[model samples]
Target chain A: MKYFLYGGCSLEAGGKNYMVSLEPVCKALGMEFEEIEDWNCCGASISYAGANELSIMTLNARNIAIAESTGGYDIVAPCSSCYIQLVKTNHELKEDAELRNKINVILKEGNLNFKGSLNVRHLMDVLYNDGGIDKIKSTAVRPLKGLKVAGYVGCQTVRPYGEYDSVERPKVHDLLLKAIGADPVPFPKKMQCCGSGIFLTELDRCLGLVKEILDDAIANGAQLISTVCPMCALNLEMYQDKVNAKFGTNFNMPVVYLTQLMAVAFGMDLKKEAALDYCVIPPEGIIKAAIGG
Target chain B: MAGNYDPSFAKEVFDNVDSGEEIKMCMQCGICAGSCPLRHEMDYPPRQIFTLIRAGRRDEVMNSKAIKLCTSCYRCKVRCPRGIPVIDVMHGLAHYGIKKGIIPRKGTAAFGGEFWKMIYNIGRIDEKTLPLKYNLLEGLVPGIKSTIEMAPMGIQMFLHHRMKLLPERKIKGIKELRKMLDKAKEMGKGGAN
Candidate 1:
């Protein structure tokens, strides 16, 4: 089936290395990616805080309208924030006509209209539901037998309003991790915030918030923390030294984007995949140590 | 250190709190407390904090070190069987206490509080001035050693064009941001006890 690949601002800004790999993987799996034509920022974190309900809803609604206009019901967003915001706006618009009307007025500025006729899904949800774990198992060229991976869902992916998975204890990421043949490490802080949204502004608080989550992953015996969001990956990777210095604790957990790990499990070349270039703590040494590559 | 406190203070805090979830639904199973990393360091663990709040110890609850230690990780809130949103209530109380100067500012420990102020005062965070600002407010040295150590990284970051001195590239929504901050500050101050 043809899907509208909703690569939001993070992807547009070249922040999502995972999305780069995901494009090929999806194509190989017989799924066609039709990018939403000329989509703007979902307003990311700022839109929710800055605008009224209608403005934010309509802004996201415009993108949904574009996808619907293409006759594409499934809009697969690789970015967790984009998926959450688009889905949330869709739900709100569908439930509240007054909100929908108000947002439509704003969309009129750009000569666009939103009828709320699309389903926004995270890449994880689409893969797990449509293709299923069996498809993943069948496609595995190499098995991730020994690697212990902690699946981090983050706040936006599975919470605030629970539509995708269990809000309190999400296992969608874990299911995806296992589907790729990696051992999913069970940790209580899976759905915690990585503090990346406010990291640029609130350095200490962000560091503290991330450190707590990372420590929990390490304590739970996770060798690497795998996440879907680039910000979460960047925060967890780039800020390790800062967190170590601030907390006076040794936490050497490497952060990998979920796609990177999946690619690795799929037997994609480590150097060709460019996983080592993106990692703050190189995965080569760890992978070599783990599997004797 | 203030032992002379009203017993109903915690109750008042609890009563005034809008957890957005039912507090009575808590099973008091200590899963929240057990799972909390800051539990050992807290004077009142998550369970005790709940108990004290339920007991109406408003002043004690507001002024407790327990609230200060919370990283707002939502571990307790997530793990709570009843889904009490304990972190939300704690955040409210912590904000209340900080405004009234009941809780001494413990530098970067109160990073959330300082963040609100920084955003409110300046349109955006000035990355060049952040180290000095953070160090001074946190009672740590904004010393030469730290700067020297950071220099290579900073220079590399600059060379790579990763770091920006001024935050606002084109002053996107600066006026609206100012107005929003003003409104937020007014609301925060007006809501204080």
Candidate 2:
């Protein structure tokens, strides 16, 4: 099966480890990830916050148009925000003609028209739904047995419109965990916001929010936290020291991209998995445990 | 925890904002209320609060224990099958009460107030002072034994160059931050009246 790989701002900005790993994983599973040519930012959080009608929806709609133009029915966005925006815009345009007309007028400047022909799925959905957990299990050279993981859904992936799955009580991550032969610990704050975009100005609020989520996860017996969004990975990993200091708690949860987890489960080399360079807690020991090295 | 109550303010706030998901859509399966860790302690769980907010019982809603106990964990927001934005609405109500100084501080809310005060005043957060604020705000002091126990980890972080003695940079745009705070305060007061 051919799938168009779409990695919005995060991949464009040289955070290519996720995209790089995902491509190989797809290929190994007998799938082709055709990179979308000349894709731009999906206008992410700012576009949607600024203008609901034109700026955000149209910006994402254009990307959908680009995918449709490629004649690829399945557009897999690795970035959670991009996935949410793309899926949301597609859902809106299909149901609302007035919205479609307004967005189409904005897109006319670039000669792009979005008729919502393509399906926008998050990497998680694609892996779990299209490829199936059984395929992932079959390809696992290194099963991640005895590893307890906290499936961090982050905000946009699950919430707001319930496009991909239910926001509050999502199961995609849990299914992914089981597929990789790991235990998915049930935590109360699985779908909590990791204070991604707001971390810069709202440091304390961000720390407080993340601390609660991490604390809840740890309290529920998770050894590591896996997220689908790079921003979520960055925030949850890099800010551990600050969060620990502020909350006076020992939160040593290692944050990693879901692709990294899958890579380890597939028995890929730890170095090749890019586990050494994470800004937050190191995952070498965890990878070793996963690989039984 | 005693404070003057105004029933209309909560109602007014709820009515003014877009009820993103209709509260009546709530099946009241108690998923959200049950999922919330703070629900048992709360006089009104999230479901009841939604009802009160929709009914426009502003003052009682503001003064309720539910608002004070909310950890903003997004558990209720996630667990609600009806897809109600419970956290946003609860936060809006809490912010309204907090700005008006109508709600008595408790748990994380009190910690948050002091945390903000320290940041706004010094333009930085000092890690050492955090424990004091956390303990005081939460109304419990870590015994000497617990403090002694935590000393090693604190030293290790500092030694590893992870914990900075001072902020990397003094926060820029204090004027803008203050202006935003003032605007928020104004909005809170406006909602109250």
Candidate 3:
């Protein structure tokens, strides 16, 4: 289970904890990994929306080439946006020879070339598909102890590449919750978009969208929402205050990374320094309760 | 309304916009609008936008804030009965809107410009600096005011150790990155080839 990891800008900045929690969890699961050297931003939704397709494509292609240069180990990108961009580059490069040629020309400037030989998979997919749920369950000595969680599968990672799970009705995360002995709460709006990247542009509209997802999770008795995407977690968790301020709703649900909860469920030793106080609705109470405070 | 409509507009879209040809497949199911997270904020919704495109409301569609407002969430694309690439259409119209100097929404393009500068100049988007630059785009007074309003969150992020007084440095061989990007831009004159 050795794969070279590619942590794009989000993990480099906002999603630092994702790596912190993931490293040990993977180590516990017998997964060996290393970070790719000198990788650039994956150009997220912002780049795709703002720049031309070729530019964003090239941005990811260059990174893929970097991984290829490192003996072409499978690249496991934790962030959904990074995963999408890199996988998309591979998909497009494989499908379109003209695109491959153009991207190769650009890569030649950087003394690299995109061979599209590297396999790109999201960390979530690898955890479920490669790591095996039963193995994870065996280590799940400490369950969530009836913590009700909603599994949110954001758009990019699922659609266009339904690699590990169904795009519309993804149940893998639900299975993950059950494996950890937590109650998997049904969210009708599971596949809905979280209105990411539009926060700065249209705050009112963006918060409205977040409001729907949050209210749904709260209504369905989700003590916390488990998500695979970093942007989804950040947007859902951090914007609760402002969303409540705008919409006048009393929704306060904690959003946890799927990996983080896996660490907790497996009873793997998570250092306190890795515990972030940034979650507006801290899972500490529930986590303590689940682990028996 | 009929007099203001340009008969050539829809044809122009098929000719110009990337994947605009698929807009013709839209059956007016309104699923796109129904699935949209920002549907309430939209004046026409995506279905109606297609209607306007077919009806040759070029100016109306281009000048409308809806084009730039799409978050590229892809809820519409995934759920669309007609398989229209809603996000691409939205971005196409946005790029087209920006190209035509029709920025109906404020701060979005400016924020995008600032973001591009940060990513181009440095390899990463430094959280500490991105907002400052974005706020200052409005003007000194409002920028400071917005920064002040966001101060608590800033402090929280600081406490969370999400920030540093110093910004992120450029990636190694950024000059080559710049060259690749310049070539990308030259190649990016049109959308996806």
Identify the leading candidate in terms of lDDT.
3
Give the DockQ-based CAPRI class for model 2: incorrect
- How well is each residue in A123-218 modelled by candidate 2, as lDDT tens digits? 887788887888999888787887889988887776556665776578888888888888989887876667654453346667877888888888
lDDT of 2 at A156: 73
The lDDT for every candidate, in the order shown, is 0.63, 0.64, 0.78
Every model's Cα RMSD, please?
6.9, 9.8, 2.4
Ranked by DockQ, the better of candidates 1 and 2 is: 1
Q: Top model by DockQ, which number?
A: 3
Give per-residue CA lDDT, model 1, range A185-222, as digits (tens).
87888876776455644567678878888888988888
Q: What is the interface RMSD of each candidate, in Å?
A: 7.8, 11.7, 2.1
How far in Å is the alpha carbon of A144 misplaced in model 2? Answer: 1.7
Please identify model 2 stretches exceeding 4 Å from their true place: A13-15, A47-52, A161-164, A274-280, B1-193
Question: How does model 3 fare in lDDT?
Answer: 0.78
Tens-digit per-residue lDDT, A4-88, candidate 3: 8987766655666676678877887889987778888877776534566677787888888887888757899888878877887
Cα-based lDDT at residue B132, candidate 3 = 87
Task: Give the best candidate by TM-score.
Answer: 3
Which stretches of candidate 3 lie above 4 Å from their native place?
A: A270-280, B4-16, B21-29, B189-193
Deviation in Å, model 1, residue A224 alpha carbon: 1.1
